[model samples]
Target chain A: MAPTPLAVSIAATIASLVLLFGVLELVRRRRLREKYALLWILTAVVLLILSVWRGAVSGIATALGVSYGPTVLFAVGALFILVVLLHYSTVISALTDRTVVLAQKVASLEQRIDELERGQDSES
Target chain B: MAKRCLAIIPAFNEAGAVGDVIRAIQRERPDVDVAVIDDGSRDATAKVAREAGAIVLQLPFNLGIGGAVQTGYKYAWDNGYDIAIQVDADGQHPPSEMSKVIDPVASGEADMVIGTRFREEGGFKSSAVRRIGIAMFAWLVSTIIREKVTDTTSGFRAVNRKGIALFESDYPQDYPEVETQALAHKHGLRLMEVPVQMEERQAGESSIKLWGSFYYVVKVTLALVIGLFRKPIPLPEEGGH
Candidate 1:
């Protein structure tokens, strides 16, 4: 609140750097899609800025009339998580619908091919 | 030109009853082509259906009833069948009573025909819980579609070419019976209900359970409400392949 501790500031900076690198590494490996990676990268950059500017959290919290500064960070983080999870849910629902359609199409085509092969066998 | 009819029986591990259902259709509607979509049944449902003189489209894995039924619609669309009749593989929908459902769709009176059990005085009616569930759906779907659909859960239905194209493109994944009517309405497809006799499952127990019924109602209600908000799919060009 009064002044940030050196150890805590150092820890936060390291953590933000680690987060940023982790996201970049995932993107490099093609593990995380660019669409989602962009979100994580933005989050990492914001954390990096907040960690470097010692007064930013407390200053923002005070402007918003919050007594506890870190609590505000946690609340905002939780809200972000909720929104991201909902996004995932919508994406998953779409994927599920497409998967079902693809399965149905594959089955129909397989049946047709089987029928055609049977007809060829009979004709020959 | 005579309208080519294809009977679609979506079966899942109903090997014991599927044969009888297929045989009945073949015997009664000899002119109608029967295509059984065996939804990855653990039993020999595909083989049995084929042996019974039905064309079996075997899925590599289980895709629930909705996906299985949609596959049948895809076949109807791909093969250009004029009418597609949905007959359950459990033998509940008697192939002899098939006309009551098929006639409306075949005659151009309705784009889709739902064979309702509530219309008749006697048949293998569902339990109290299922009746309540069905009644709730009947009220909700009828209000949404502005049509009296007595049996919202009846699988014994028939769809014309328009209905086939709609379902082949989009269908709900689970418990699709009730929501499909709303979808049909949104797509501007005319629906009709005809009285039909349904038999008890010839071999296995009913697939529905108490908890499953609760889930079914909640999920379908959500689907219907969401359906109201979503834009309706434009019906494909009439008589267009």
Candidate 2:
């Protein structure tokens, strides 16, 4: 038997709410940066809206001539994940570059201090 | 006014050859201060360099050749050096040929000067495969920038204060020797190359292996292409004094 539209909507709404609350909890605990949590929250809210408004997905799917309504949800979800992953990768790459620069600065500063101390000792 | 020159030698696990390199440079140019960027070497590179009369900047971790060289540039810029030269610490670069690379920069004729091995008759010839790769890069860079470039991968280079300011802040992190030429040209800095003698490494292996060479070619080529489209980095005000 095909699952009723109401049941499908309830399940999706619950899942999206769980994701939204989980992201908030993580942000509050300082485990996830608020900047990144905002993106997760946006994704969850969009998913929640789509699940509540059953006709919205079907309407877009129909407008796009997609036969399956659920397929539209899955496709959009996959795209969001890809975008989030790419964003994180770029952020990580920038952080890695900055870390290398910081390490170099620290090393040079330490060497300078050593030279200064040595000069002082020799002079005394 | 005479420019204060600093020679920066970036070394990694090169204890055996770095000391000799430092000593040779001091002998060749007594007036020029020498500093060795010891890139997290487990060996006695720092001790050897210091004993040989080089101020050593020992990085806490290995940041590769580019990071190491940038540290030298930063030191030069911060300490009010008028000229900065990069010489590898593996003994491949001949300190006796330092004048050949430094003269153009010191004279204000060029902002940056590179020491080329191919145009010269006396330098140690590279392997055939490496030579081919170098030739290809030379051709590509010259064609793209419309400037004749004979040796794009030479690490021996001298830069004036303006060049120092540019490189100190925005040097490429890996395989920078070639791509930096494009970068220099992009920033409207004058570039020149002089023939200089080079030698085979006296001790220790090259950082790049045979397999690594292939990757190096691809990575540098891509970097050069992307670099063409990048917004030109603005020169620092007052050339970082």
Candidate 3:
């Protein structure tokens, strides 16, 4: 028996929804952050479309002389790493600024204590 | 009413020895008015100080030694007292020798007088841990301030108008002794020390345990050393009276 068009469409839709939910779960568990989550969700939706219409993607990859599987995997991996590194750098900058503020506070406190000591000694 | 000296005693749950300390100071120098700063005491320290005829200034919260003493300085400054003495409520510092520390200030010879235990035959006798801590702190103070301070952590001290004004304005809240010494030097105040013997605490155990003492010394030493490089703090508007 041949696969019907309605059955193929339903399977494609289900596969797309499952991939979207899986990506969102990764985000919720912090295995992925917001930026990476958006990218992953988009990739998964595109992959679902390609899985349904493999002929178009294969045609494009063949014209570009690249293996479709390896190319897509590399694109996703690179994007994830770049986004995470950018996030880490932002965090480090914030921590450095906080450390500078704390050092200033400590210095100010020391000076105030010094002034008080002088005042006391002179009074004596 | 005659102008009398106000002795500020910073007490923290010193119930066992606070009464005796108050009575002893009163006996030694009855002319001086005493105010015990009860720093959120959990025990009957407030009652004991009051029973011993000391005016109790109950802090709303615990402010440690620095905050408690600063409150006393503020009280003395506001009340028009001629002098303020920062004496421990613990019996470690003998009330009998309070006069020796106070007389110099009374005679106008020194602006601040610190009771130096090292000057006497028997110096401080805490645990070996505390002794090493004190010595290291003393070294740090001496190096930064260019004065050979024998006692860097002695609590028995007296302050006149200038000293009171200084403390009232901006006193330190942690590891005060060494920081106070460096501050005194920076302000160009006449700092002097007198020979006095300090006894062990009569009632409670020392708040600084062995490991705590080590941390205290290291922390204060680093603070004082860092303070040496920093610019001096500007005097407050109502300071140096």
Candidate 4:
């Protein structure tokens, strides 16, 4: 037997609520940065809205010429995951670049400090 | 005006060989100042290099070969060095051959001088697989830049003040040795290579292992091809600094 529309909606609603609470709890415990948490919160909110409105998912799927409504939920979930993954990768790339620059700066500063100390020793 | 030359050695976990490399440069080219960029090595690379009388720049974390070398270039540029020579800290590059590579840049005949081991006279030879990969890169680079590039993978190079200024701001951070030549060419820098003797690495395993060589070729080739379509990096405007 196929999963009933009511059961699907309830499952989506529960999943959305779990994600929203999980994200908020992570932010509250300082396990996640506010910037990153914001993205998850937005995702959870959108998923929550689609689950609670019940007809919104079917309406969007029908409008897009998709025959099945549940497929839309799966599609949106997959798209959301892809987007979040891309976002994290971009963030990682940026952090790597900054860390390199920081390392270079720290190294140069240490060298300068050493030179200054040597100069002082010689002068004394 | 006499040229102030700096030998920039980027070392990562090269504690076993870094000190000897620094001392060798001192012994061979006493006129040149030695600066070692310790690329966040967990080993004693910084201490050994400093004890050997070379100035050490201790990076807080590892930035691989490219970032480490770029850091050296930035140091050379900021410190007002007239010529910057790159020497591998693993002892593959002979310190005695530095003047040979540096002479072209010093005389203003070339903005960048690469020390090539692929020449008929150079005694050093890499594994057959590596040589093939190097040849392929050399061919690709030569075709695009319209200049014969013998050793695109050579890390031993000397760059004049102008070249230093260019690399200080923009340098590739991944597998940079081959791509940097193309970058130099794109920015209108004259490039030439001279025959230089090399020895087997004294210590520390090669960064690109046998298994990783395939990945290196693929990744670097893709980067070079992609770079061809990208707009050339603009030179810093004069009097902007």
Candidate 5:
């Protein structure tokens, strides 16, 4: 009743190929620098290997002292979120500073205009 | 004869202590032209400044400190003032020590003079939060401008023609110390540091609260980085010589 060996092999081959294609796309789009692209490709390969070979994952989990369940996935997801949030905070802070400075510049210009108007009025 | 000096006091809702700041600066440097930028204060700050013999530039709406200071710089640059000093509206910056920053710029020694509390006798500010923020900002400023700046965010300072031109064109609005230094360095203006004493606020709560100060530091750091890489904003309609 189990799926044939050919079907499992075909699915694994397709998933791994997709992972490699994604890594290549990131590099081609210049979203990942060449030097960093190598690291990303390596990571994708490791993930593919772990998914295809159950023995590799169990060995990794045992070595790392983590239960081979949702725990490892959850930990990785949380780390990714934390990193993304930190990056976002940095970007937002920079944007706010620019806004504040720009606003100030606008305000100063307005003040100067007002002063000039008042000067002209007084002279006339 | 001593060089002509202009002290720009940028104020916003600082009616309580701005008068005293203007009066003290006048007492110290009677020859220095004092201009009070009343940044849409919903108080008698403008009247008080005028009554104290300071030329008042009343903004129709709140432009905050950066706007007020920029207005002063533009006036100084256009009107042929030899030196322009930025004195805070709050009484935190001592008027007596105004000479520390002004004299350097006036003597042709420095294009800009930053009053460095870091170099003061007490070493550095004691506020734990402020200290951490200052250190991080100092590092960031150094990285951005590729120059060493001990106190990256001190407000009380002085500038001459070179500085006047740069800041009159692109002064930062909120928490501007670090950004100002970055801009100055970018423009190849000479910057010097002088030891000057600062006093705690004399009256009224500081507009910069604890959390606000934290946010200010974080925001300013990012602004500096982005500003360095981003294209500058075009000068506003009121830009002048």
Candidate 6:
């Protein structure tokens, strides 16, 4: 396996570190719920491990007959992105449906309250 | 006790047409209580419906046709309505023909009755393209539900308490008319079609434009097929949310 450039490896490791810390900061600040941050944290940790142990990717790439090591990383990275996006799609669908139900209930209750208030006013 | 009937008129920006639609229902069925679901219209839909002697449930914003209609169902379910008929606010569903749809449900003949424009002729038959689309959708929904549904996309429907409970708890969100029959059938609710004369919409355009017909087909097909796999929700508790 051709050795990855020292500068490139160092930059990747740093970028991965930044991502891990960034997600952690968001979690600490309560900006991201743990349920959602769990996937992000897992992603950052995997990215860091791959960047630091550069040989792991190139070694697998050579076995798979892939010409370049980074190409394999990008391919796997794209698949990871697709899976995350699909998860997001499901979350959004469920949330919107729940929102619709909530809106319906709230509207109904508000009308009921208005009628009750009008009844009280007329009774007095 | 007499069955409590509710005429649910779901309206968007059809202020010009909604008032007359309400009056027509009052004229045809004085015993049935009318409730108009005002789906966040920019005009005076809520005011017009209320002034026309109907209770108006005004949504805070537009919820599309499905959401609006489901809101009406929820209201029917919550208030212990024994029968609910969904008529469009645009006047396409003539309230004059109200009994043709309502009678089946009231008499315990069917859990739900869809008022079809395709049968018994003489009224708006829809455009050439819409007729083809209506046919295809009927085939798809009929095959899936194992029921012969002629006008699968007709929004004009009447539902008994059973059907109302089924939908208020679990209703399709988009292009709901086609999927609702399948949903009701799967839950063991009986569906029947009655021929009724419909009029050209009194105001505003249909939600589905001609250009979006292709997308409508694909989306509705997906919703119908995907729906069959979902587990049926437990029946809603009597007289509760």
Best of the candidates, lDDT? 2
- Write down the worst ten-residue block by lDDT for model 6 chain A: A27-36
Model 6: per-residue Cα lDDT over A1-124, one tens digit each? 8755567678878887898878766644446544465566667777777777878878878999988777766676677678778889998997898699788888989999999999999999
lDDT of 2 by residue, B40-149 (tens): 89999999999998989988778888899999999998899999999989888899999999999998999999999988686777889988988999998898778899
Q: TM-scores of the first chain across all predictions?
A: 0.85, 0.90, 0.46, 0.87, 0.51, 0.89
Quick one: ranking by lDDT, best first? 2, 4, 6, 1, 3, 5
Residue pairs clashing, model 1 = none
The reply for model 4, stretches above 4 Å from the true place, is A1-124, B237-241
* Model 1 RMSD in angstroms: 10.6
Off by over 4 Å in 3: A1-124, B1-3, B236-241
Which sequence of candidate numbers ranks them by TM-score, best first?
A: 6, 4, 1, 2, 5, 3
lDDT, candidate 3, at B239: 31
Tell me how far the alpha carbon of residue B193 in candidate 1 is from the true structure, in angstroms, after superposition. Answer: 0.6
State the displacement of the C-alpha of residue B34, model 1, in Å, after optimal TM-score superposition: 0.5
Question: How do the residues B1-241 of candidate 4 rate in per-residue lDDT, one tens digit apiece?
Answer: 8899999999999999999888989999899999999998999999999999998988877888888998998888878899999999999998989999999999999999999997856478678988888899999999889999999988999999888888887777768898899888888899998988889888988778888776677667755765675566566543432
RMSD for each model, in Å, please? 10.6, 10.5, 19.6, 10.8, 10.2, 10.1
lDDT of 5: 0.74
Q: lDDT tens string, model 1, A2-113?
A: 4345566677779879988887666444465444655566677777777777788778878888886665556655666677788889979978976897888889899999
TM-score of chain A of 2: 0.90
What DockQ results do all the predictions give, each relative to the true complex?
Answer: 0.05, 0.04, 0.02, 0.06, 0.04, 0.05
lDDT of 1 at A107: 95
- How big is the positional error of residue A64 in model 5, measured in Å on the Cα after superposition? 32
| lDDT of each residue in A35-56, candidate 5, tens digit only | 3344445545655554555454
Better of 2 and 4 by TM-score: 4
Local lDDT at A95 for model 1:
81
TM-score of chain A of 4: 0.87
User: Can you write out model 3's per-residue Cα lDDT over B1-241, one digit (the tens) per residue?
Assistant: 5446998989999998889988998899999999999987899999999998999998755767788888998898877777888788878888888999999988889888899888778756666766777787788778777877878788888878777777887676756877888877877768888999888777766656666765565555545654565556565455333
**lDDT score, candidate 3:** 0.75
